[model samples]
Target: MSRGTIYNKDTFLTNVANQLGRKRQTSSVSLPKWKKSPQYDVFSELSEDALLDEFVKQCEAIHTEVIVTEMKEIQKVCEQVIHDLGGESLVYWEDPRFIKYGIDNVLEKKRETGMDIYEWSSTKGTFNIEKAERANIGLTFSDVTLAESGTVVLFSDKGKGRSVSLLPKTYMAIIPKSTLVPRMTQATDIIHERIKAGEKPPSCINFISGPSNSADIELRLVVGVHGPVRVTYVVIEDE
Candidate 1:
């Protein structure tokens, strides 16, 4: 097809000049100033017991179940929590080959609750998000942060996916109390050290402080908006 062509050098130059002027104005434009700087108390004074109690209260308020245990009592506590939550708990010895020992407990809890349990193998294509949405709860082991934020850091490598924590209605995280830190600075240092040692960070690093909540709607607080409505931390202590 033949296209009509017209040439107006002066008009074209004027248009180019106008475009450049607009570009210059945009480039020099300044963003709106924020009203205030975000504030966070990274070094709050909180005892281990106080933190645990507060964490437990937060979990309970969100209808989550906390299963505190020691290394030796993981099995028993897992069974009890499952039974109390009206879920069946079974020992899947074969799971150890693929899933972490702590995650196996969470999977057992899901199994008791009649949820399907599958090993997250690389060959197993991408996970089904729809199925995960229907799940009542998700359980996993976290690399506990020693920071005072009471955050649980989890990587999305291996069988653990970030979706498992976000998609489910409830999330039960297993953390060792011995790994607790007094502040977030310490947590960052630990992560930095790991990175310095030539260790690749996990695909995801989630710092969960409390259940998913939002006060966006008319300033009325709501829980479980974009993620799990309930988050329970099972702090494992030494016997």
Candidate 2:
């Protein structure tokens, strides 16, 4: 099979321009200036520490447990969280941030204690999903975090399977303080800038707000219907 090219695009456009009695435009279009832009104003005055506080408060409202720790204590704190959550088997993304944040050490220590640990791998294929489904805990790092809604953005790739955040019984996100932004406005802007700079976007970008919550059954609030039953955010303060 052969693929089609845009060989006729210019000819078609020239025909249209001729019909309209105008030349083909080549410059990029300018964005409109809105009368009022309130989206960028919210939480604009808050400092980074204040934003972190707001993020924590929002997490509480969404039923997510937030833990603040320093870089040196990451391994200890993560180990404690795993123990508290009764995580016997864990599935995490094959992200280098895990090693930088000391989570690799934590995973190794846990494995030495007989707990099963699985790292999402591109080479493993379907085995990644299988292990994630059976794992007790799923671990990932947030690429961007929104403070207003306590949302963590995950840019999923071959090594960073979406199953690592979706299929496990419990989900944990290691958030660096620098990733925290005001809200979706800033998050989208960051993503747009990256794309505008000619970088290819990820196949999937998930914006998760705490554990999954639903009220479909009898109008009663239920959590974790389609995803992890429990969600934890371990925020590194100095990072």
Find the number of clashing residue pairs for candidate 2.
Answer: 0
Per-residue lDDT tens digits of candidate 1, residues 1-239?
Answer: 25668789667767787888842232455659768633334335677766666656655655555667777776667555544434422221122422443556556566667756544443344544444566666656666644444467766675566666777666666677666665556667678889979997766777776678888889988888888776666678742
Question: In order, how many clashes per candidate?
Answer: 5, 0
RMSD of each: 10.2, 3.5
Q: Could you give candidate 2's per-residue lDDT for residues 193-221 as a string of tens digits?
A: 99999997887999999998899879998
Measured against the true structure, the TM-scores of the candidates, in listed sequence, are 0.64, 0.88
Clashing pairs in 1: 88-112, 146-180, 146-181, 147-183, 148-183
Q: Worst ten-residue run, lDDT, model 1? A: 89-98
Q: How close is candidate 2 to the true structure, as a TM-score?
A: 0.88
